[model samples]
Target: MKQKLGNIFGIISIISAVLYAVFFSLSRKQFTETFLVYSLLFLCLYAFYKLSKHAFHVNYRFLSKKWSGRFFNSDVLVLVLAVGVICRLLLLTYTPNLSQDFFRFIWDGNQLLAGYNPYLYLPDEVMRSGASPIPNAAFLHANMGELSSGHYTNYPPLNQLVFAAAAFLGGKSIFATMLWMRIFIIIADVGIFFYGLKLLKLLGKSPYLILLYFLNPFVIIELTGNLHFDGMVSFLLLLSVYHLLKSQQIKTALFLAYGVLLKLLPLIVLPLLFKKLQWKRASLLCLAVGAIVLIGFLPFYSSDLIEKYSGSVALWFGDFEFNASVYYLIRAIGYEFTGYNVIETAGIVLPMITFLSVLLIALKRKNEIPEVLLSSIVFSFFVYLFLSTTVHPWYLTIPLLFSVFTRYRFMLVWSFVVFLSYYTYSNSQFTENLVLVGLEYTVVAAVFLWEVIFFDKNNLQKTKLNSL
Candidate 1:
């Protein structure tokens, strides 16, 4: 009966997920009703799985004990992952028009293809003209209200380059562009997992860690559900770090630069790098890579890269509304901001404080660079969270991913919880307001404090020993 129930739960989970994906794909937007139904289904499945575990007399011990002889192996994990991947592919194929700012990408790509600078025209102007040099109709409609008559795209040209490539291959069909772009993300997802596992193995980690990340709903939903290129950025960052540890310093620097070119945030890791290796070697290598990235990005990219990037980063300070952070205190003070200017200002000042302070402490003690990098990453993520104008659920993944190296189990659990918070914003029934956002941040703050103040020493010791 227990085994049967477990099977039943598994089947239900899969069916409900597929149903949600199918409905979302067809609708072109998430259906509040459908999402609610899917959430209920998942909760029910979770309950059933718990019941099955007890009834089947399955080993209740942790990964320390092997429960079902074959259930924990790589082959089983691979099969489970395959199902997840296939489901994502199916959903991507069916999902209606592009999501979020994908239409902007199409618009920008169209501009680029026509020899018009995307940064020069507002989306409204492009749509008003109705001259689709790129061919996706949805792109025209999506900009109807977004263009304030003078709004230019702030996205860097690299992403637009990818979109242009997809449009070139797929012609004017939105679906075709989505399909090709999504395929790249799908490949990136798989590559991230494979290389992530390789890095863990190199560090002598158990295969369970691989299963944890690969099977994570957060990863599945983010990479597949949203089809974000963040997966590719993540893969490159991890691969670069892996090479760095192997003493392939020059190649590692190049990869890091490449990662930054894909997404600029990875450049933050470079500062931490200079402190890691011999200052001369690290500086030269990083500079060389920076120069290469600039050459690639310079011509098509905006000259106001810093200002534009800062404007985007400025969005974080608009309020203290999201799951957990010191920003709650800031918002509580009743400071009003139209954008994250205050937060951006604070971020600029505060990160320097945290980084310099931590660097001094770590250098004084001669701590391993990995430990410093982990600390820097965590601090940078928090600063971003605290001042960020937009606090998407997946943003938490950046910090949480690095915590794995620190042997921070609490962070893993917190990551899953934060991942689950996707439902909060996702729940179309309830308007996402400060109260709800506050609750989410409250949980995140509690979790962060627990990990930092209470668990840091123990986890660090464990990680140190494991590395040795």
Candidate 2:
């Protein structure tokens, strides 16, 4: 029996190591390739299933030692860290296949080094006007895709700082710059692991739950494998939360300042901090975070910054629509009735609704404890995501991180199936298959209801919602 279990563990380790390569090398072009992507997703899901089950059933009996704490086994903790590091390091130099966002990342970095605020320059205009040129202007502009080339960059100032460093250090080599960016993201993931461990310990959940964030293949592919700086934002957000839990308001404000400057998701959860600290302190923290964000924007401060940034963000809510759930359903209704897209209207209303919903969550919940605090925050994000017009796969990582502290496993289900959205890129036109999108969300909704509603003390097995 022990031999069989040990062999299962060995097989899991080997399979995960091998698949990390396949995941890194995957190309997104669809025709004649759907089967491979689906197969890879299936195998990855299987790995998650087996590891989660093994972690629970054996309860780390195999990794535990006399000196280990009642909750976490340090040996298993090392195993989790090793897997995350090895998987990411293997993809360090590979070009991102599943996303072209990295091209824009490289372009932004090089643009910053060219004595221009990346936020202010439209890449397409640079090529057309022949302005102070970025080296390899044609190559970067061409590869960054028309949509990105035509738009003013929405990436915040702190992110641009990292890009400028990569550009400075990497010289003219795109791949070299990509290497530096990947290194930065890998370091951020390591921070996520460390702070995540401290959080799980503080919350009194299984420390192994960090695997849900670090070991998940989708996280590896989207954040590390595809060179998205959402990884960096997530790390800072985790650090901020850890400080908040420790009652270090000044430290929390500083970390959150950088996090919100990198991306807006951290700011979305800011009100939740009110649940942890007193009213006066929380107000001060909010002001501090805001002041820092304004200071961060000051260097790149342009008359166009606020207007251009808000317009760019407005595109996601009104102009852009992809892999959305409720928004799609609403859009279809509008098309049937008004014979036009309702995104302009829906975008205006949905965000208003999401704001009130999240505010209600933070105010109504007793969240001094990590479990409730994170649970309310994750659920608020669920409301936000379900109503969002654009739900990228990487967007799920924050909720997935928080859900670990609570009993919710819906984010786990969403992560596995979210890969289905990549099928949109299979054709050149970038059209999502509504059927596949339907299948994906139906599974998600079912699992969500099961975990949140149906599962209880006498019915833990009800999580056959396919989570563990």
Candidate 3:
């Protein structure tokens, strides 16, 4: 009877997931609809969780031998992955409902395809001067927003290559460009699933755990549905770590460098690796990483490239504030004291603190082992996000991916709650509900603190027992 009930719920969950994808794909493109769609999506996810917990418990022995074997079979894994892929494919038919960033991506790619340097001209400047070189320049400029159009692009070189590929294939069709980008992202996601499963096996954990990331609704919607390249970035980071654990230092360095070129966030993890290798090999690794990054930049290298890129990056620290936590509190305090917003001071101080926190984690932790190193990287990323002036929902994807290798599940919890930040998009005014933002961070921080304290206590007890 129990087994029957579980299977029933499992079927319902799958149906619900598919229905959610269909509704999401067909819904009107507005942020106001997000709450309803996301709520239903979460309900389906919860039902799936209950199905797995109650019906598929490892110790449940009510099933026949054949059925039980089937439950744990490799075929089931393939089926689950196939379902995820189908959901993404369904979403691919619709325009991105959540983000306009893809417009900038297509625009930049068009620039590259036309032999123009994207970094040399801001979208507004190109459009205003009537000197735009890219096809569909007006459409992209109108959609990418004033903030994006005013700034030189900050996408790294490797990411530009991907964009260029999309442009070359997409030509004048926005849908075609988006489709190509989504295809690339989906391919990268497939790589992550396989590599993540292997990494889990290496850690002596259940390979099924990879499904948590691979089948995650957030991963599906944000990466494949919205065409975010963070999915590719996550895969490269995981591949690098996997190679590192296998003692393939050169391959590890190369993958890490590629990941850094895709998204600069992986650079923070480099310091944590110092203690994992001898000084001589560590020096070589650093040199190799530097050479790879330099090579990536060679084609675009010019005096203005540095200025434009660095200036664009500095805006994140100096100007932007969104879905923040510790930085918000400090900013609030500054506002109360000074009678004005003080992002200028808070931004600078917060990032400096984050830098010192990551440096300390690198120096203080015993990261010679793979698990220890991964945990430190996760912690460092958490600190950086906690201190960041902006915490986009997709940014949590980084720490969430890293946490899969460690004992931490706070980042998993974060993946769900981060969706609340999208409420800011409910209207064009872009007004944020501080109350919702506060609620989101409060829950995430509570989970993080609980896990940190309890995980450390458990580790200390294990250390003591081992010593005896």
Candidate 4:
């Protein structure tokens, strides 16, 4: 009877949270106090359910083990998350404005599929010229009345190519194009979730940790509901790490190369590949993989690829966003953010120093794939976060996903808190607002504290099976 009650409460809490978040997102593209109230209410109910179940009595092994009763609990959590996703998709079709980002992507894809260089034009440009037929097309018409510098198209070509393919398949229907591309991302997210679960299991993650990540409302809503492609990059990275764990050195190199192709940010993990292997072997692997990636990208690689690459690299050091690592710390202290270059120089140098230290430790440490992947993800995430000019909320998924591999439950919680803030940030609802900024910083501080101080390492270790 007690267990049944706990289950009922858990389900109710999840449903409530999902409804609140989805409704809040649709209403104003912002999570107001009312939404937070609902969130808190569900949180309280969830806490009560957990207490009734004596979550403390649940051993880490029971939580971490794959194919266990705990896994069923996780499945229930995922089902609730799926409900959130359904709400998001329904809103995408039914809502008038849908998403600002989605609007931009569809416009860009149409340009590409129409035999025009989308990289050379912004949506506002085409909309003003009466080129796009999508509804509320005037919403894209901007007051600037100037051509954008085409800098935002710096994202890798593979993403744009996939978007173009979707647009082509949808013919002239804008809604169909957007839906198809969104579905593609959703499919990739499924791969990320299941494979991520398997990876966590391999890493000796407790079933609870698996539940923490897989069933986490934040991950599901962001990757599945939002139809974000960050999941593809994350999936590729996890697969790369999995290959490396199996000691498939060449295959690992290829996988990592492909991951970087999907999203260039994964290149940061390259240092880890070299850290353990012989110099000759690492050099050969890098050369082979680099060749493959370059060959695949030959269609998009022009003579100006070098110039474009340099511009993209330089763009990172030109600005500081408050949500980023260490930059938030600096910004919180009243320091003005200069160009991305200046801060990135400092950010990159410091993390490289930290990376060297961690690499030395990693060499001596009996490392599992989960540990290595987690360390790399965290290290690279902060390094780029502090250094990069752009820090999108979806980027947070990179490190957050790997936390499960390390059986870090707090990361899952932090991911959700950060996810909640994303709606406000992306919509510019709280842009430069002091109160929202403070709230964000407070959450960041809490995450840092929870992960560094509160998380128990021994408890994580105890959850692993001997065979693992």
Candidate 5:
């Protein structure tokens, strides 16, 4: 009877996945339709969870043996991954639905291919001047919106290179450009799957644990469907850690640098490596990583690079506030006292706090073991996000990927609730629903606290008992 119920839930999940693809492909711009798609996607995820739970409970030994089998085995693990790949491929045929960020990516890529510095001019300035060097400059400028058009491109150098490759291959068509970008992200995701499985095995965990990341609808939708480069960042990060675990210090340092070049967030993890290596080896790794990062910046190096990039990045702290957790609470308190928004102060102070917190975690945690290092990374990023002024849905990808290695599953819960952040885009005013934001973070925070407090305590007790 339990097996039958599990099978039924699995069928429902598959159907929901297909329906989600259909609706997503048909009307990406319609909020109501998009919401329906998200609803179905979440249902699919929930059903899968139930199916797995019930199946595991019904026949523990059989399910364990089946899931623990090799990659080629005819097991549910293979089936889940196959379904995930199909969902991504189906969405690949459609243009980016969730965000227009890809337009900026294509625009930057075009600028690079045309031998122009993407950082040198704002899109609005270039369009207004009518002397834009990029092909289809007018079209790209119009689509990227005033907010993005007014800011200097702040994407890191390696990201620009990926953009350039896509633009060179896709030419002037938006669909073609999106296709190329999706292909890169999908390939990167495949790399993540390969290394994720290997790392799981090396850590003495079930390889099936990889499905938490690889089969995650949030990852599939955000990275593949929306064309966010966080997927590449996740891939490089996992590969770097895999190499680190294997004691390949040079390869680890090189890949870590590459990950940093893709997204600056990875720089926070450098301190965590200190406890994992000897002082001399750590210094050399740091120097090598620094040199590689500097090399990536050499092409776009200029007197104004620092000024422009810093200015653009500063807007996130001072000017923008969205779906923040602890920062929002602080902002409220400040506003109650000052009769004005206090983001300016909170922005500066919170980042310093986050930096200090990450440093503390790195210094305090025993990161020599792979599992401990992964947990540290997860905790550090959690601190970063909790204190951030802007917690975009895709930003959760880092912690989500890392959490699969640790016993904590709170990040998975965050991934599901993080979709609520997209509710902001449902209206033309771009008005935020603070209630939804609160609910999202509240649930995530509750789960996080439960894991860190109750779950960890119970696990510690079990460990002590087993040792006895």
Candidate 6:
């Protein structure tokens, strides 16, 4: 018995070591590095993750030792979290390699600290006028990419406020600003680790499932290494749902509104409230959320804020395309018929489909119960991404949060294959290979279909199969 537990513990340690090495490598490697190297390392990291997950479940489900045992579960949980933090600390000082969005992050932050509205001032115009308004404006404008430099920042007010705080604390040193920002992100991740565990337990799930998100290589790389704040958004979203399930309506409204201010994506889940809380309570919740969101935006309000922000967002649908699934097929068909890219039409149409799909899922799915509500939220996000004209890799963080509560595993699968879309960055043209895109989506779609169609007989949820 000791030997068996020791072996499982050994596997867990080995998984953590490999994850450390993988993140160390990713922090040093640029996106321009060969796609083969990125794919190989990511695939290898994922293999260990799967192995560790299997080992964990096998030890818990079959062994006489209770995975719920206070000492055992506590030690393993600490090991999982300590590794997660160690992996993040390794990249705390490194510049973001996977995305240049952080350059714009600092740009926005400095703008706020400098008393300039990020949404009102365009980086390109700020630079061309020979005015160095923001600290390190020259370097930031040069590297923030033409697409971002030309437009007003679309990051929400709370997000920009975070950036502002970093800018104020970091002074003129980009590394310092980055460090502060990374610290915030890491703290948010830690919050997610604890809240996610609590939420799983509240949902009657095995708390061990939080490891699926906490220790994911994809999450560590994207959210921590790349300095994206989707982790913060995820944390807030989780808190909102946690409180909502406990019938703490005011707390739920506050957290959900904060999440919406951080990133408007959480708005999609509002439809679920109608079914779960019913029309009257849900309507009041929506009104409360709306008031909070309005207050968040009021501090930075201007006539141009809405128009500029909406136009910048519209670019994602009308002008940009990447890692898309159904929209790509529809795009190819449009090309065949009209000999022109139809993102303009598809962008408008696909969102309508996504909204209606969300409505259908919210209304049709059995969501009055907490478990079904959680799963229904995941299903809606899946449909939204399925029909979205643009699907960034970090966008998967939403569904990944729900996987701990539900049987859906496609989010984990997608996290692995989504790196294939990075093949475009390997070259100067930054051209996406449709073949890689198709292959990535094909695997994700297949797994999604299978998981949605069939429940795992031995699903390591909250079930007790002690007689087995």
Model 6, span 327-372: residue lDDT tens:
9999999999999999999999999989999999888987888988
Native-vs-model 2 lDDT? 0.82
The whole-model lDDT of each prediction reads 0.58, 0.82, 0.82, 0.57, 0.84, 0.82
Q: Kindly list the per-residue Cα lDDT of model 2 for residues 74-191, writing each as its tens digit.
A: 4456666776798788888788887788888888888888788887778888888987457677888888888888888888889989988988888998878889888999999898
TM-score of each: 0.76, 0.91, 0.91, 0.74, 0.92, 0.90
State how far residue 88 of model 5 sits from its true place (Å).
Answer: 0.7
Give one digit per residue, the lDDT tens place, for model 1 in 218-311: 5555555655666677777887887887888877977787777767767656656666676898779878877878776676656665555545
Give the distance in Å from residue 366's predicted Cα in candidate 3 to where it truly belongs: 1.8
Give candidate 5 regions above 4 Å deviation: 1-16, 23-33, 49-74
Which candidate, 1 or 5, has the higher TM-score?
A: 5
In the range 1-468, model 4's lDDT, one tens digit per residue, is 545654665566566555644543454344564346435534643544354335424421222346535544443334433543553454344322222455555555666766766555555556557766443445433411222223445556677777777777777676677678767766665666667656666766543344444444455455545556777787778888877777788778877777777677776666566655656777787787788778756766566666755565555544434445455554444344553334545555545655665565446543444475466566556555544434555677777777667634444555555544444544543464445545654676676666665665544666665438
- Over 4 Å off, model 2: 1-7, 31-72, 456-468
Output the TM-score of candidate 5. Answer: 0.92
Question: Between candidates 2 and 4, which one is better according to lDDT?
Answer: 2
- Best TM-score goes to which candidate? 5
> Which candidate number would show the highest lDDT if scored against the true structure?
5
Candidate 5 weakest ten by summed lDDT: 54-63
C-alpha-based local distance difference test score of model 5:
0.84
